[model samples]
Target chain A: MIPLILYDIPSKLDGTYWSDNITKSRFVLGYKGLPFQVEWVELPDIAPRMKEIGARPNKLADGEEMYTLPVLSDPNTGALVTDSWEIAEYLEKTYPEKPIFSNKSKGLIYAFGNAVISLILPAAKFPIFRASQILNERSAEYYITTRQVMFKVKISEFSPEGPTRDEHWAIIERAFNTYKEWYDEEVGKWLMGDVISYADIFIGSILSWLKRVLHDNEWEKIVNWHDGKWGKLLADVEKECKKV
Target chain B: MIPLILYDIPSKLDGTYWSDNITKSRFVLGYKGLPFQVEWVELPDIAPRMKEIGARPNKLADGEEMYTLPVLSDPNTGALVTDSWEIAEYLEKTYPEKPIFSNKSKGLIYAFGNAVISLILPAAKFPIFRASQILNERSAEYYITTRQVMFKVKISEFSPEGPTRDEHWAIIERAFNTYKEWYDEEVGKWLMGDVISYADIFIGSILSWLKRVLHDNEWEKIVNWHDGKWGKLLADVEKECKKV
Candidate 1:
């Protein structure tokens, strides 16, 4: 068996967190029944190994660089994988016993699933989200202000009839509508099908993060559908952190 | 030899050019000098196959939303791959003779290469670069106005003792300034090394787009470097397109 090590860097102002996409990869690996050791090294302590591995410097100023997290290493293959989504792909490919992207037919579905989740990583990291705590007292006002700016940009990019940016609310609302319509058509526990594929895991991870960042009860309920299904699986894997 | 067919939707919108990253796969496939077909299908003509393939409508306006373009159908494997980068991976994996990501290293370099290219894509699509005829008369003014807004955002984000957003400037000015610090490093022809990796193709595509969009003398020099490297290769591939 190849020894797998996750070289984790500590969180900083740049929105690095143990629960971010990098750590979620460990969960995915665990879900696939893969054994890996976690070497949780804080940023200050990461210099030597990073240099040895020729890891690029973290670019984001407030926290660690966005590109640097969740570095995966397999000494046997002498493979070091970075980029959270790509790491998931490597794990799935390397360990085919329990497949993540089980079928190639559903590649786009899985890609979109992963893309949605990956989108959350940035959306969650938006400076506004970090300022959420400080702006909690003025949450409504801040939300209105920031959301207006975002909406203005969206409307400017796509006129009343142009292709809507899915990241925008109107588009996201439409996506939810589409998902709901599809769910109604086929009552499946997962997004793509009966079996959990990478899509389920990807959307599940983002839903998990959404549940964390969203404060409103209505929004919580909407995102919680995922909790009843894949959320439980993610939480179970997350419980492994305690054991670690 | 597997029969591969690529359906492309050409649009200036970044998402439309699905064939961008996978150009190398197409290049390698053709250079294997195998027989294949490349079909440039406009958005109007791509609905039926898209539904059959279960592509989620990415753009809301198109109710008939298809995933990113350049969907490849491999009759031999019965695989229909979507998402530009994944298509490249499939091509490399399935056709190992002339591998796109030749140095496996478990896809570490491939992921970073893709990421680097992604960063360059947005920079290329920054309106002024793409439709210079519309913006050229006002581009100088536009550049100053946009830079000021970006600088203000940077100041607000990193207030008081503002860490120089100069790196952002460095990336933008890369075409104009050849002697930037990163350039002095003699980091080979590409970011990774001598061998042409996906990063080279991805970065090369973005650089090409920038050259076409920017049309500045300085950027032309940058394109000249790319022309000597990736551009020549792409032109050779254009021959295969004629056959397709």
Candidate 2:
């Protein structure tokens, strides 16, 4: 059987693989025990590479171009898929025996992920974009330029200090508090009880990103918050990753 | 099988019943075909009435007092429940025949509702608070005063016209767009597919409030947005309400 090809984005500086979107596909692959080979594409090469594979680009409501990574190609069927959610759905359909999302929880999981993304976006923006520092020269330049265009501010200005930093931290704290309250009420080791699913992977990807990008003290503060559930979940994801 | 009593806040001016919180309980009762009666309480009278029934008030993280309505009294068990989510859970437990939420989807539903509340709050605030104009003299005075203190602005300033209104509308549009994108991906008739659950009820309550408070034109614009899905869902909920 031909192995599945997972296209991922590599950091420009060290060529290390790091992307929440790509992590999602990786997590699903690991969880399902799917045999896959990673094809790391740098930031500047993403569009051309994706175009060669016929992977669809995400477009804004106004028809603005928005290129993204994490495309998967199924060699068995010769099918190409893009978008993390779509890829997960594809895996579920193609490999029904190991379902990433149960039928009953599918819509809820999708909605919950959307909510998590919305809540975490503000908090994650700085650290995530700042991680561009680790990218290779060309990729770093591309990343900075694209991000500046998106945020309408210089990358340096993205770093909030003093009152601004405190405000940003407070927002992050509130987002985590919201998650913790839900977790406490649900009383689950995993997001959806004992069994791990894409929901965990989705959240775990965010936690992993934070761990990678945030300074030790900053990461320590977040992981220590929420009664250490964040840290435990991160560890659980790492264990899952190891099984792959 | 004594009828459950749902305590709701009545509008000040016409003493009519209207509240998203109360509507949640009503929706659950209606959906489950449970026998229940609403006891109308005014704003100022809410805390004392809730206290009399031993309903707990929600407190902020800072331990500030934040009293709210929608308390349910189940005569069968003599149990008093506060908070819409809590009430739904209690009703589900008490009357297991008709489930409002599936076990697997409960946490996700809770999280989704929180996210919706967060996104819609800013857009809904002005019209919601402005609806206080319909309140009776004392209740209206109480509403304005409390809201002013909470928002740190006079009630008159809440009305966004011209550019401000446009900005607020833009925010609302973005929020609905987010929901629409999720719904499109999930491909659900109801939030949780064919079966209407507490999630739908929760969202429908918000829609109902918008219908009640927003100006005819304003409400029309919203309902017409998202390819009339909002209007259709509101109609569906109204149909469900009529069944009771």
By lDDT, who's the top model here?
2
Instruction: State the number of backbone clashes in model 2.
Output: 8
Top DockQ hit: 2
> Which TM-score does chain B of candidate 2 obtain?
0.92
Residue B228 miss distance in model 1 (angstroms): 12
Q: In model 1 chain B, which range of ten residues has the least summed lDDT?
A: B176-185
List TM-scores for all candidates, in order: 0.39, 0.91
Write the residue-wise lDDT of candidate 1 on B146-211 in tens digits.
544644542123212223333433455543232222222223443333444444455445444554
Candidate 2 TM-score restricted to chain A: 0.92
Instruction: Kindly list the per-residue Cα lDDT of model 2 for residues A59-145, writing each as its tens digit.
Output: 665788766778899989988988888899899889876676765567678878878877867755567555877677888889889
Model 1 has a DockQ score of: 0.03
lDDT score at residue B63, model 1, on the 0-100 scale: 56
Error of 1 at A82 (Å): 18
